[model samples]
Target: MTDPETLAAATVVVPALVAALVWVLPRTWVTRTALVGALATGGLAAALTAVALTGDRPLAGPWLVIDVPGGLLVGIIGAVGLVSVLVSPAYLGAAAGALVDPRRRERTYYSALLVFWSALLAVPLAGTLGAAWLLVEATTAASALLVGFSGRATALEAGWKYLVLTSLGLGVALLGIVLLAAGTPEGGLGALSWQVLPTYAGGARSALVVYVLLLAGLAAKIGWAPVHNWLPDAHSEAPAPVSALLSAALLPAVLLVAWRCEQGLEPVIGVGPARDVLLVFGLLSVAVSVPFMLRPMAWKRLLAYSSLEHMGVVAIGLGFATPLALAGVAVHLVAHAVAKTLGFCLVTPLLAHAPEAARSPVSGIARSSPVLGGAMGLSLGSLAGLPPSPLFVSELLIVAGGFQAGRVVTATAAAVLLALAFSCLVRALLELTLGEAPARTGPVSGSASASGSVSGSVSGSASGSALPGLRGVGVLVAASLVLLLALAGAASWLPASDLVDTLMKGIA
Candidate 1:
């Protein structure tokens, strides 16, 4: 067997290779092509994680850094990619039924999906900042195709908007990279490497500008507010599993880029200003997403807004820069990924059953499909930071860290935004999961007849009964619970004094 270090490159490359295979393979083989790609990537990610955790010093190539953080994120991207692929058949089955020519476009859809997965893996593991940025651009292109796979006017519009906005954002990021590179002793592409930037800590102005530009540019991709106009549209139009991968995996990949830049700049700007900027943006994103969540919309769009809220929470925790807060950020990322993916999965059946009315309407959820309804409820509750969910622990840690950092106003505002967002989510879920069935008439009913067939049957059959797929819901719920338990355990096992000491030592 090949050593894990050697396999790291393969882990990143395999999905892209599979994407090429999807394009070349016959239409009948698209599903198999996606499965092969997902499995290969997943296996490589697992191997990389095992080696990084157990080996003396895993891969450390000139263009790749398989450290603990990189390994953790790469493993997560791979795991989420596998789940997305598993759910793709059902999702695309529904989509194909809705599309004009399912057979002709199916190959394109699968190819783009595979490419998106590959780009996601590359974003976190790329050793050079420029390479990571380029990978993010690739993901944007791939996702644009998937977003528009339906060939509807709305889907095409959303795709174009996403492409334009993200391209502009990346252009800004590239300029930042250019500025940072120019400041380097060797200059040009040599300075673009993550390993090289820290060596030039003396150039304070250049480092600060680079940090600001990178964060702002990446914030658009991360779905931060003010620049987040494209998120809801793209997410609502894309296939459910694609939406899940976008929310659960892609957002965090961009964040890893932001965090890397933060680490490089902390020595120069100090933590104060850098943290303040994040806190401000975090607060704004939460504030903006809350009102949208309050308004009625499609289930998937609602989930997209929820993603904005959770990403805000992450930014807030990261802004604190305390060891406890950083740990909370990590925990929140994992919990949110699992919970959001589960939510997207549940929404799939809901959309199929309810369809879109002139006004958003949901009915017969609990009565017709108790398992899915319950799963949706639990996932939304977890996202809203309700008790016993890992998000609750993570949010509390973030708020505490904010106070400890002496940013009292920011902490207070964040708490308020969180409360508002939670309330809005609860209200939306209640409407969807507990209401009576709407009147079945008009075009809405026709669309529902077409879209809701599978969900209605599944829900009707599964009520007062169990199905194998329900096991997936159980896994999601259990994962969130375990995360909360782990947070509690870590709190007790690792003393605050030790944590502070360790963090400070790393900083110094």
Candidate 2:
């Protein structure tokens, strides 16, 4: 095997080269070629992850660093990206109104997807704050196109909303980065690198200003409340594969950037203020998502709100900044990624079989197709924090960590919020699996498409173009169940593991 650094670079480069190749490839060859590239990208990323996890220290390159947290993220992005590519052929086959010219539609979609995948792959491994920020911004452009790929008025509007909102938030973050750089002793791009930021000499007032600006800006991109107005619309409007990447890969990758910021600045600004900022964001996000979850919203829309809630959980775990919480955050990240991806991937089959699910709650999914229903059930159940699911264990660890950190009230409040959210999701699960099926009167009148429009119908079915994709989803669901259970089992010793100790020591 190649060295870790070489693997890391290849992970980002292979997809990019594929993106370029797909742009010029014949329409007939786009999906096949893209899949090959995706396999290579995933292989390299997974190899790098193994190298990082086994090493005692961060594996550093000139432009990249594969630390434990970064390694986990790379692995998640690789897995999610590969699955997205796997499902893209099915999506494109059934979809219409694509934003690009008909002759170039396949090439356009695959190119944008591979480009977006490459950028997400790079963000976790970025060696400096500036590079990470640039890579994240690159994702915005590529994914916004994917989000609006349907070319419908609603899809286009949602895409534009996502682009504008995230860009604005990133702008604010850029200002904060500039401020930090100006105050650093060496006063260069290198000063803003993760390794150097911990030694920030900036005074308390300046540091506080920088911290607020950074967190507030990152909050929008992470879909944290108050700045998450674009999240629901974008997630609901994008293609199923694209939605999975947004919720599972993009959100957490950006959150990692925020985590790095906190670690870098804590020594300069004091832990109290930094921790408080994160806690506020986390609690507010959870509070905001609960009421929405209780409402009988659309399927993709509900998952969108759930993303807000789950990201909040991870944020709170980060804020607690204890060994147990870090461990919980780790487990939660992997569990949430798997569960959320499965949920979104199911949208293709769900929408194809029952178009009405786009506007109202799903019902009796199990009665329609056993495989589809079972997968949907597992996805929702896992998200709801049911026992035997890793999320349940992770949440417990987070609460315990909060107490260990001496924030009893905060921990208590978070636990209460989580319980309330859990009940809401459980109710949703029952309604999803057991509620009476909606009467399909002819073609659905106002059935929303995966693209967030009401015009598209079930152009394909489980026995049609979507059949292979549904089979793929079934395989993913089975794999996820075993993986999540393994994570739950691993939680027993994760808190005391060397990785947790390394994280607790502060990566910066």
Candidate 3:
């Protein structure tokens, strides 16, 4: 026997060890170091998934558990991390080339990215809720450096804000964890494992208090309203690749934690109370992010708000707790990850050519780089839940689930908010894709050749400059398309009942 328990722990710890190695590697070898680290993480993720699917049963150990849900999430984080590393050569290559100390900065960036990936992978595999909490905190710490990698005054400020807000949120979550521990049988003193939660979940009052505390605290981390101040700043300031990972991977990881916590408490306080809280938060996040999306701002910031909106949608699906809704939530998480990553990748090249593209003032990207323009259009369209996109299927499932759950009013409100969000996003996309290219001044005849020369020079030297290669915008777009097809096919064939059964069993 290949010792599933040992494999499960290794799946996570090995990545962390690799990240540490990347941190110490010579500056000149930063690219190779990052690639090696990412490859190791991806391989482990693949192993974990295979074990979950083909192994006899869930792998259980004192430190970790490779259950179906955890396996699925681990695979996602790993796959995405791999793509991130592929893109990093190009993206971070461009950044490093522009830096005062390129070698040192490249090492720092790659190290931080690897560390972030390792932390993200660890959370889902944790056997205990306490360990999960620690992993989430680790993600914040590792990503914070990446957020402020530019070392600009604004980047620094944004990083500090992110640190303070997330730390506070984690603190509150810790308090909730402590309370839950205290309420466990035998005066709450025990191993504090997630597996034991159901056994001691009978104390309604304590469970309710702990659930509320945990949800409220973690809600901040998920970028829910009122506490979502750090999102725009952090996402906007971070490199595009980092931003993609943050939005597409990090937020979902925290949401998974919240989902697990809800499952733990549902048996005690009933699903109604937990659903109610999710509904409230979902509505608030939608309402708060909508107006921001409508306003003119940086391209990355706009995407960040879009992330908030999507998180709200995920919350709604989770609150419904119906099999259809949960399935939708699952599919939507995948859809959002692919769409957002592609969108971020597309914008990277655009921003390089026209710095104002980030501000939404420059237009006509379709004429400048038709491929990227189309990719951006498709990504936004998908994110808006338009037909043919996986988001559409997920949102519909969520709505259906809400109706089934007798939350007609809630469903109606979510639908309306989604429609409004869709409209706003569509309008922005049109302006960016269809408008005339801003006029260039001075020596129009030589501009084309000059621009081409510059573009070629930039692309030839740095990894990011040659984006058509592996892990480039082209690859991201292809991946998005494939995922969308898979989602649509799965939705059409997968039974809702089966999803419900799996969710119930997994959570129970």
Best by lDDT: 2
lDDT of 3 at 429: 79
lDDT of 3 at 391: 90
Candidate 3 stretches with Cα past 4 Å from truth are 1-3, 53-57, 96-103, 186-191, 200-202, 440-471, 497-500
Kindly list the per-residue Cα lDDT of model 1 for residues 1-508, writing each as its tens digit.
3465477778878988988988888888888878977898899988886665454443545577666556667877888888888777756655434333655576777778888998898787787788999999999999988777666677778789989998899888888888777776766666777767676644776677877888889988998988899998888777778888999999988987887777666767777877777887789899999999888776777888988998889889878877667667766787788788887766444555445521254655665567666777777777877777778777888887788788888889988888888889878778767877554321111222112333333233435224323445466556655754675455433326443333333211
Tell me how many clashing residue pairs each candidate has. 1, 0, 2
CA lDDT, every prediction? 0.73, 0.87, 0.75
Model 2 gets an lDDT of: 0.87
Estimate candidate 3's alpha-carbon lDDT, on a 0 to 1 scale.
0.75
What TM-score does candidate 2 get on C-alpha atoms?
A: 0.95
* Residue 256 miss distance in model 2 (angstroms): 0.5
Pairs that collide, model 2: none
lDDT of 3 at 252: 86
